[model samples]
Target: MDSFDAIVVGSGFGGSVTAYRLAEAGLRVCLLERGKAYPPGSFPRSPHETAKNFWDPSSQLFGMYDLWSFSKLDALVSSGLGGGSLIYANVLIRKPETWFVNESIDGGYERWPVTREDLDPHYDSVERMLDAQPYPFDQKPYEDTPKTVAMQEAAGKLGLSWELPKLAITFARPNEAPAPGVEIPGGDDNLHHSPRSTCRLVGECDLGCNFGSKNSLDLTYLSAAQRRGADIRTFCEVRAFEPVDGGFQVSYIEHRPGQDGDPAAPPLRGAVRARRLILSAGALGTPYLLLRNRSAFPALSPALGSRFSGNGDFLGMIVKARRLQEEGGDGELVPRLLAPSYGPVVTSAMFMPDAHDEGGTGRGFYIEDAGYPEFLNWLVENNVLTMSHRVGRFLLRRAWSAATHSPKSQVGRSAADALSKGLFTATSLPMLGMGRDVPDGRVFLREGHLDLDWDLTASKPYFDRLNKTMGEVSKSLGGRYWASPLWLLNRLITVHPLGGAPMGRDRREGVVDSYGQVYGYPGLSIADGSVMPGPVGPNPSLTIAALADRSAERIIDDHRRNPAGRP
Candidate 1:
């Protein structure tokens, strides 16, 4: 069995940062990622390819999306070399200073043991490593991106706090004008040895940027970790771990091609010993793993499965937005020229004050312009953009030309116009809102599988506020808002699932402590969204990375003070 100074599970915002920091400190670290590595241009695009993109080992399907459809809510998280960063929208907003609540929230979730001040230095360190930058909206071509302009205009008219949030995307090299398809200069080539480019305004950030414009974790922290000689093995899924005399013993399965998921044939497992084990398998993953392997850690905290939240995620779509014309009635409406399929997935964010804070209302939230991929526009257009009518009109015109024996040179032009940028898809916009929500959700193993017992009842008031505000934003844009179908059923999906092995002041309060050390276990730590005591009231990725960086400092200091059992 192979061994190391530390074994970090799941190369996410947390795992990647920890691996890099530890490797830099000259500690032997091994990172285990369950999903395959996605270099630039490897993400699926066609419907056929996308249909097979899911993470189900039993079905021999190891893809990016690892979905957990619990009774009340569905959670979508990534399982890849870079984890959620591969699928995220690349927004890097920090948790609000006031939101690092020193007291427990309404639903008995633990108070945050660490605060913004504690994470400030770590936040700066992670930002520098990821090369975070705001969308260059002030620049020429970027400024004219329709969704960005439209979002800004609507926020200004509605008195919402609007600003371009920082993105972990390389819009340009340092001190260079924003240009599409330009090579990004970096200290180390990404793990795949592929070249990265600046943002190409392709609206593919959430779908994995083929141009590598998004400064994803694989391209940044994980790359640096590799350079520092950290052993990074993808397609290695850890299944069990237990504390040992000197450290911990870990067991994992290696997923390879051509392996049949047969009932009779069990998977071949491997084991390793590490001086320390840091679990960074994300909010959904880490909790599920711990709950499933509870028998191994007999003295784990009672709060292991508590303090779960979706970070107040709410999705609502707005349609039929009007563009004010020179001559129109008091309430005339025209489809706006905002193309939602042109820029990165998210550009501008509108901030609403929280009741806990001095500014205003109920639990605070953020509404950002959630752009879609160019291909999704076609799906939207075909579903709701009068496709039948357009096809009928085209056939009629072509039939008329043929019957009249006319030279119809303009037929191709009409076909192109019908397929490109229809008003319905151009004006339709998805507003993504997330913030503080009641964190009373629980996760536990049922029949040896992970499940969550949570609902919208406790968080109803917070979501109501979010809905009302989304409705106002829609009306301001000359449209009506429709809640997502799932939301109508009081169910919501969250990419930012947080708090399962949450941190607290003591074992009675949480599973982990302020430095991410597991409360009862000495060398075991959790450095992911699973450590969040409550909702971060922001995108949460940056905060997760920052918290991991802070934890890494403690780990390095302890290692220096007491050299462990090593070769």
Candidate 2:
């Protein structure tokens, strides 16, 4: 069996940061990522490439997108070296300090064991490491981004505070001016060892930034860890773990990459021992692994699989926004010229304060301008062709009648009008919302498979308020609004799944303490979204990393204080 000082499962924000911190402290660390590494320009774009971009070990398909379905919700998470950071929209907002509420709930009181003050320093460390920056909407070329302008207009008309949230993307090199669509000069140092470039504004952040513009874990934390001599093995999935003498034992499966012109490969079993083991395989993965190996840690908290939440995540769209004619010649409404697929996945956001603040409502949530790839825009444009054809027929008749009635013809104007009739897609935008929702959901092992028992009914009031705000924003933009397609069918879709082995003051309330140390198990810890005791009220990535930073400090201190074990 292979041995190490520490082992980190999953290479997302938590795992990557922990590995880097531990290795930087001179401890031998091994990071086992279940998915393969994705270098710049390697993400799938073509139909054939996209078809194979799913995670299914049984079918020997190891790809980025990992899709999961449950009775109440559907989830889409990334399965790559950088974990969800590879596919997530790079928003790095911090959790609101006042939004950390302590309230009674179904299972127990939903409270945050660690306060925002405690995480402030750690948050700063993560922000500096990520080199976070706001979208350069104030600069030329970017200043006229249609979707961002539309969202700003909507927020302005509603008298709301709209701001561009900092993003983990590389728009320019250090000390250089902001320039888009240029090669990032220092691109050779990343873990993937691929050339990278600045943002091309292709609206592909969520599908994985192929240009390496996004400052994902693979480029930031994991790269630094690798340079610090940490061992990072991709395509190795940890199956189970158990505490043992002076350390812990981890069993995993190594998946081999296919050779040239062939895609068939076999999985090989492996095991390793570590003085410390940190489970950071994301919210869903960590809890599932713990539940599967529950018998090994018999004294774990009962709240291991409790407090699961979608982070109050909700999606909606504003379609067919009304726009004025070109050159402002006439007052008649025309199809909006704004293109939702022209910027990063999200450019700007509006925050809705909670009741704690004056003149605010229930729980707070953020509504951001969501975008998609140009391919989706092309698909949307294709769907409007039939509508355009019908309008073309109508315009042809009008032109024919005018020509027959008058010596001079207005057919040119009529033809131009026909061509501009169908623009529903170019005028539309998607809004993503996530805030403090009831963390009442739970996860469990059923028939040796992971199952979620999450119901959105408990958070109906929060959802209703969030939806109303979204509708108001859409209405202000002169467009029709509707919930995400799955919402109507009573199903929620979330990319930011959080909580499971939540942090608490003691074992009675959570599986881990404020430092993310498992209460009863000394060397066992969890450093991921699974440690969030409640919803982060924003994009949880930054907060997850901050918490992991604190956890790593605690782990290093514990190691120095008691090198043998924590008996």
Estimate the TM-score of every prediction. Answer: 0.95, 0.92
- CA lDDT of every candidate: 0.87, 0.87
| Runs of candidate 2 exceeding 4 Å displacement | 105-109, 260-263, 324-330, 383-422, 564-567
TM-score for candidate 2, please give it.
0.92
lDDT of 2 at 121: 99
lDDT of 2 at 208: 89
Q: Residue-wise lDDT of candidate 2 within 3-82, one digit each (tens)?
A: 88899999999999999999999888999999999998899999887998899988867889889899999888889999
Candidate 1 per-residue C-alpha lDDT over 1-567 given as tens digits, one digit per residue, 9 for 90 to 100:
898999999999999999999999999999999999999998999987687688998887788988889999999999999999999999999888888877744555449888889989988998898888898888888889877887787788878789898899888776888887788776237788988888888888877878888889999899989999999998889999887867988899887745343332445688888899999999988998898888888889998888999999989888878866643556555677668888888998999988767867778999999887877777767754567777778888888888999975766788975564567778888999999998999898889888888988889999999999899888887877888899778789998999989888889888999999997788899999999888998899999999999999999999999885752
Error of 2 at 446 (Å): 0.9
Off-target runs (Cα >4 Å) in candidate 1 are 186-188, 259-267, 327-332, 383-389, 404-421
